[model samples]
Target chain A: GAGVSQSPRYKVAKRGQDVALRCDPISGHVSLFWYQQALGQGPEFLTYFQNEAQLDKSGLPSDRFFAERPEGSVSTLKIQRTQQEDSAVYLCASSISGALGGELFFGEGSRLTVL
Target chain B: AQSVAQPEDQVNVAEGNPLTVKCTYSVSGNPYLFWYVQYPNRGLQFLLKYITGDNLVKGSYGFEAEFNKSQTSFHLKKPSALVSDSALYFCAVRGLQTGANNLFFGTGTRLTVIP
Candidate 1:
């Protein structure tokens, strides 16, 4: 089976610009998660979705960050007015169930560089 | 609050020698611990997880993790290190007792297996 996939493996954006990263979860996955990883650091949670419902967005660092999963199959993480501090690899993961114990499959991630 | 800790910034091991990557966690209640690995320029891949009923959990690529309730540790181990095993390792924890759907990740540990 194909693993989770993210588009635009690398993106360079100017400060104050808006950018969108896409994620395609594994087929039939019901849970999707987004994370941010700074250089030399582990990933930090961003948001979560169970099907089309955005279950948690508390981990989002600021209001500039937004995410949506309209149909529950593909998801997008959008950053408005990007800042240099937002430079990092954005990761997406999906799991079969919404349970905390379910194994998550991750994608290669989209590396965004804001200058 | 739920959190995970990887005390070592890096671990170096000689090929054919045993290797260990330590992780400790703190949460309000019983936790579900997991291990993930990421090669350079790649996404995180699930290695193993400890949910319940077992202290020793075996995972992909001859890797295993031992869950210690007393120490609140889940240290990843491999009997014989291979150069290909060199990568960044992450430890994650979620509070199963509270049904928290979020995973708290530790500051990852870089593992270098010298051939």
Candidate 2:
């Protein structure tokens, strides 16, 4: 893809429900990242992957938040037993280089509304 | 831990006038600072970064940021504001430490350019 693409641009989940968002990064991107953005806030780091290896998951807020980039191309973010506080936009980004200092290209983001 | 602060919740500027969005950071090691812009229903777009050497770093969309090591600040500035530039701006910081590659973002500043 020319740019990062995300699926389920908007999701409405009831309390305790599970939701999964998907991201397809740009072609040949070596680094992928996940972030959560609350209303009126900046994007918060959630996880990072170098190729298929998950190098950083320290930013995941809770046990309910999970992310995986199995093949190094596509990634998924899963939230289990969603809560009202989890309502926010989930963003995925990718960079051509594996280093974290490189410029990141972002997707349209998945807005999750936990009701 | 690395963190960034964007003190103002919003900044109002008139078109054709100069605009500035302030940002400050704290980190254990040398910091890598970045500025990104976000539009409604869209992903964040990287504006500029300050790594080494120069204090003033120029980036996309005629945006530039000054890296002040003394003040621990990296403020984004533009000589002329445009109504189309109205968006949300975020400041992020990444430290030089091995395990500190994850970016810590500020709470974002909403920029409103009046015509």
Candidate 3:
């Protein structure tokens, strides 16, 4: 089976520009999550989706960050007016369900560099 | 608040020697702990997790983690280190009682297995 995949492995954007990163979760996965990882730091939660519903977005750092999983399979994280501080890898993960014990499968992530 | 800490920035070990990566966590209720590994230019891969029951949990690639409630630690360990095992390791934790299923991750420990 194909693992979770992210597009545009690397993206360089100018400050104030908008960028969108895409993620394709594993087939049939019902739960999807997005995270942000800064250089030399751990990943921080961004948002979550159970099917088409955006369950949680509290982890999103700012209003500039927006995420959508409308169809429940593919997801996109869009950053508006990107800042140098937004430079980091955006990771996407999916799981079978939101059960207490389900494991998450992660993607390689899209590294975004804002200058 | 749920949080995780990987005390060490890096851990170096000789091949065939025992290796340990320290991880500590804090949460309001019972903690669901997990370990993940990331190689350079790659996505994170699930290593193992501790939900409940047994204190010792075995994971992929001959890795194991010990859950200590008293210490609030879930350190990853392996009897013999392999050169290929070198990578960035992250420890994550989530409160079982928290309605939102989000993981709090540590800064990550870079493990270097010298051959």
Candidate 4:
């Protein structure tokens, strides 16, 4: 695809339910990132992957949040036992070099609503 | 820890007038700064970044940002505003200790260009 793609643009989950959001980055992007954007707030970093390695996940709010990029091109974010506070737009982005100053290409995020 | 701040919750500008969105950041070392724009129901779109070059950085849609290390600020500016430019703007920063992969963002500012 010409741009990053995300699945289930909108997700409504019951409290305690498990939900998964997927991201397919640009064809050759090397760095993938996950962020959570709460209403009226900027996106907060959740996790980062370099190739298939989960290099940084220091931003995951709790144990319920998990993310993986098994093959390096596609990634999934899983939230277990979802809570109302988990409601937000989950954004996925990818960069070609993974450099600190590189611009990222973002996908249309998946808006998750936990009831 | 690296952090960015966007003090204004919202900003309004008349079409054809100049517009500015202020941002300030704190980091342990030389910072990597970025600006992103988000339209309603869409993901972030990259605008510009300030790495190690001249303080002025130009980006998409005739937008530009000025990096002021003395003030720890990176303010987004446009010479002429358009109603179509109304959107949410975000500022982000990454420091050496935070690694090159993860970005810390500030609460966004909603820009309204009134016709």
lDDT of 4 by residue, B73-111 (tens): 999999999999999999999989888678888899999
Off by over 4 Å in 4: none
DockQ of 1: 0.76
Each prediction's DockQ against the real complex: 0.76, 0.66, 0.74, 0.84
**Interface RMSD for each candidate model?**
1.2, 1.7, 1.2, 0.9
* TM-scores vs. true structure, each candidate: 0.98, 0.96, 0.97, 0.97
Question: Model 4: per-residue lDDT, tens digit, A17-115?
Answer: 999999999999999999998988888889999999999998999999999999999999999999999999999999998788888889999999988
Model 1 bad stretches (over 4 Å): B97-100
Q: Which stretches in model 3 have alpha-carbon errors above 4 Å? A: none
> What's model 3's overall lDDT?
0.93
What would the DockQ be for model 3? 0.74
What's the TM-score of chain B for every model shown?
0.96, 0.96, 0.96, 0.98
For each candidate in the order shown, give its overall lDDT on alpha carbons.
Answer: 0.94, 0.91, 0.93, 0.93
Relative to the unseen true structure, what is the C-alpha lDDT of residue B8 in candidate 3, on a scale of 0 to 100? 98
For model 1 the local lDDT of residue B18 reads: 99
Predicted structure 2: lDDT: 0.91
Winner on TM-score between 1 and 3 is: 1
Clashes of 2: 0
Per-residue lDDT for A1-115 in model 3, tens only?
4999998899999999999999999999999999999999999889999999999998899999999998989999999999999999999999999876777899999999999
RMSD of each: 1.1, 1.3, 1.1, 1.0
